[model samples]
Target: MIDLSFPLREKVALVTGGGSGIGRATARMFAQRGAVVAVAGLDEAPLLQVAEEIVAAGGQALPIVMDVTSEDAIASGIACLADRFGKLDILHSNAAQTGEMQEDGLIAAMDADFWDRTFSINLRGSMLCAKHAIPLLLASGGGSIIFTGSGKGLAGDLDYPAYGTTKAALLGLSRYIATQYGKQGVRSNVVVVGLAMTEALDRNMPEAAQKLMTEHNLVDHLGRPEDIAEVVAFLASDQSRYITGAAIVADGGFTSHSAVYADMLRFAAMDTGAKA
Candidate 1:
């Protein structure tokens, strides 16, 4: 039998936006797998809660309140974790902002400040994290860098253009890191997340929109934060030791079907007297 267990025993992981949603799920999952985790976010209360939960569960965790856009803060957070864990093995740059998840229309409607602020958190922040974390990763005999991307990065969208651009940039950055550090045992990959039903999505998206998405999804459901966390865990572990410079889609087949597939399914359902 092939061993499919993803074991990260003794690994040290640092996750941005770990206070909630996908970041929180991934941080907790990493700790559950035996990795000493540092959960970083702008909110200290939620970060502390996550850390306490991990400790209560018999896992090591540190809550770091740091702003990703600040180089000094990123450096301090990385140093704090490194000092405590002795080394850094996994860096999950999961922090992102979608300009309040508003539909910031086409290029004509986008402002310079909007684009800059989006990139500041989505792209540049990831850069700073990698920049400071790489030295520690290298010192720890190489590790993994997991970036969270989105399907919009690959597909064109009429809204949130800035967010899409930043996500695409992350894909490129991940490839660059993989090429530059693969020889040193460091691996880098991007997790292209789909329409996950995170708390933010629940609060922002209407029920009808979510239902329409579910209808289009090949798996017949929206992704959960834990779904993405599972893949992040895989990429962070030795199971994916040979995988790098890759965009692993965790979208529950959302992008796997053709545009007409939903129609086709509807037609079949109608012929079979099933709900379309």
Candidate 2:
């Protein structure tokens, strides 16, 4: 008989950007499912808060202050996890450069430094984390590596070219990791996320912009951090054992319809009114 309950029991997981938003939600969910979580992030305060919350909830957690942009920092963080937990069963590389769409715009006008910086944090950071953590995963007899991706990576937009490019690169990187290590029992995947109601999004996006996004979504409401967290938790668990090298789109059907979907709907409504 297959055991379905407590799917992540006894697992040791690490989540980058685990201080807040989807990362924090996922860390909490992992702990709830019986995994000991290590929450890593640039800020010690939020990480500690999250760790303490998990502990308060009767789960084990460790807060590690890690700047994903630095290879040394990433390596050191993983080492610390190994030292404390002795093994790693899951790695959720969820950190990325965010909340700077204006600066990440139009390729022709983009600052070279900004472009490089975005890649450093969004793309290179994941690469470094994987590079350091893969050996530990292998030592533990294989594990899951999940990258937090974006819908922008799948489809082009008029804004945030740098952000989109880096995210798209992650899809390729995920595939490469999956191909290279699948036989060794390691699985790599990307969760291509939609706009969620994270603290940053709520603060940064205008009400009109939020409404426009909601209008395009198939669901009546926009996503929440907990929604994406559920997807990440599923990918991290053994329940998804047969899945690998895949980009699972969890965007509330944001990119599923045609570009003219909304316009078509409006036209249909007009035609119906005219007939009536």
Candidate 3:
């Protein structure tokens, strides 16, 4: 019988952007679930810290300094993973150009260089990583490739046009990979994420803004990094073996409801108060 427990025993996994937030959480979870994780990111400090933390927790981890925007860097990172682990069974391409929301604003005001940079890191980086990792994945007899996408990709937004556009493009890239490599045992899928309470968001978002976002969410609380990590772990494991070329939304119902849902709730509350 197939193992339904979603265990990733002895699997070798790589998580880009594994220094913090969802990537860090997923790397930890993957370790806990029996996978040897290689945490790759641009910064060496956090990567080392995350890897140390995993080691402290009785899991094996390798911290790699990688700049996804550079093909040479990505190729070197993958080579390091292969050198250390011998084979790769799961790859979570979670790195992206972020933290410049204001600069990535409306297309009309978008900086040409900024837009190019966003695509270079967010879209092109993922492609390059896949191109280098596919041979190893196939060597390991097929594996999963999970892309970290965003809800903005599926909906029009007032800002962050470049970010949204790259995320939207990820959906197509994932589908293409899934189609091209499915017969060869590779699976590629996207996880469309919503706002989560990460360090950056918690530090930047105001209380009122958080409250407003919560009101729009169907869930009682905003998402946490661990929440998204769980979804990614599922996709990384064999439990989701039959799933590929699809986008799994883990947005806490942010994209599930109608655009007017939040407003409708407020109007209903007012009507009820008036009747009372």
* Best model number under TM-score: 3
What is the Å distance of residue 250 in model 1 from its true position?
0.6
Q: How well does each candidate superpose onto the true structure, as a TM-score?
A: 0.94, 0.97, 0.98
Give me the displacement of residue 218 in model 2, in angstroms: 1.2
lDDT of 1 by residue, 1-276 (tens): 324443888799999999999999999999888889999999999999999999999999999998998999999999999888899999999999844655456797777887888899999999999999999999989999999999989889778889989999999999999999899989999999998888888998899999889888878689999999999999999889989999999988888889787789889989889543
Ten contiguous residues minimizing lDDT sum, candidate 1: 1-10
Measured with C-alpha atoms, the lDDT of residue 232 in candidate 2 is 89
Give the runs in model 1 whose Cα sits over 4 Å from its true position. 1-6, 271-276
Alpha-carbon runs more than 4 Å astray in model 2? 1-3
lDDT of 2 by residue, 89-191 (tens): 9999999987565798778899999999999999999999999999999999999999999999998899988998999999999999999999999999999
TM-score of 1: 0.94
Ranking by TM-score: 3, 2, 1
Q: For model 2, give the 10-residue run with minimal summed lDDT.
A: 1-10
